[model samples]
Target: MWAKLVPGKAVATPVISYMLNKAFTYLVNYWRTEDMESVKAELLKMLPHVQAVFDAVDWDNIKEQSAALDAWLWQLRDAVEEAEDSLDELDYHRLKEEVKARDEQEASGSVSKLKGKLIRKLTKHVPKNGMLKRLKESVEGLHKALLV
Candidate 1:
């Protein structure tokens, strides 16, 4: 599937995107109920948007790449949330450290090639309030830094 969608030859986003799509699809499919249709519709809408994001990236597919990374992070967040212990101070701090590492890599252009996907992945986990908000804010800060 990725051989053609991704321009300038094969790269990581396609691999990551392929995986993200599959994982998200699987999770949604597994847990989905009466609201499944709406959720899928929304995800369908995101396809072109994700594509447009790829277009804007120009090269190295930063948006798409980062987006993939972000997706992975969110999965982690969800997993953490589901755990009996939840995100304790130590865990939260570790996540922060990870985010910081990502931001640093982004700032130095280490992951610049994959920024759009990166941002997409980073922002997708925001849960609307509380602990999620703090995480969202941190990711947003990283997103802003990428633009600079």
Candidate 2:
């Protein structure tokens, strides 16, 4: 229904959609993380359901809805915002690692080049375990919110 109004775009494409798009672009053009592939797939699988829920909302009459629904909406919004922030953090770390690697590579001398290569190998730009865990938790939160 929302898609028809937009001619080519779905009106329910909210922060989650943007986050997924950003993650996909980064994975394709800048960073590659095997761990994130599963997470991305989970998010992609949930996207249609999330969009449908969003599209079903009667925004014009939301103010007249039960307090429980209002609360649920707030929770969903918070989860979405948290997910966006986590994605941004991932992007920030990816860019930071990329820049650091580039700077190291720019250093002169064979020793420096070898050291740079070693460092890059040892500290590949994949998300750290802690960040990945947090991201997974965020996705869990989103799933829980949707179930509410």
Candidate 3:
């Protein structure tokens, strides 16, 4: 992976890598799916606020007192790790649906009408309401916490 290309412990790489991974995983699994798209769109809309908070973090100042912020950092790290895992699960479900769709399509012969129907089903993935709500709440919480 790019991890080898990019040195570990580099100042900006970790943040960039983490954000890219999260965005990529989310989009790969949910991009065209209407229900997930709406949720993803909403999250995208809130990125500016999140970016603002991220921009406000003073790494230089934190480094001087890293020990003091250890507990706070740990909490933030845990939250981020949980969020990443949740997002990655989207790909799992997507892959599962892909397999099921393939199986269904294979069982149905190569008729043009059936192919069209298969395409439609493949495109219309159901959204996970709870996950979407949780994601929105998590983003809102971040916005609020950063505001304080």
> How many steric clashes between backbone atoms does each model show?
19, 0, 0
**Any idea what lDDT model 2 has?**
0.67
lDDT (CA) per prediction: 0.42, 0.67, 0.51
TM-score of every prediction relative to native: 0.26, 0.66, 0.51
- In candidate 3, position 12 carries an lDDT of 34
Residue 85: error of model 3 in Å?
A: 1.5
lDDT by residue (8-78, candidate 2, tens digit) is 23444555666666655555444445666776677677778867755666655654655676677678768
Error of 2 at 24 (Å): 9.8
Estimate, for each residue in 1-148, the C-alpha lDDT of model 3 and write its tens digit. 2233223334433463455346445545544344444544554555565555345545555545455454444454554555555555655766777777767777776695487576767776544756645544443343333333
TM-score of 3: 0.51
Order by lDDT, highest first: 2, 3, 1
Q: Better model by TM-score, 1 or 3?
A: 3
- Tell how far residue 78 is off in model 3, in angstroms: 1.3
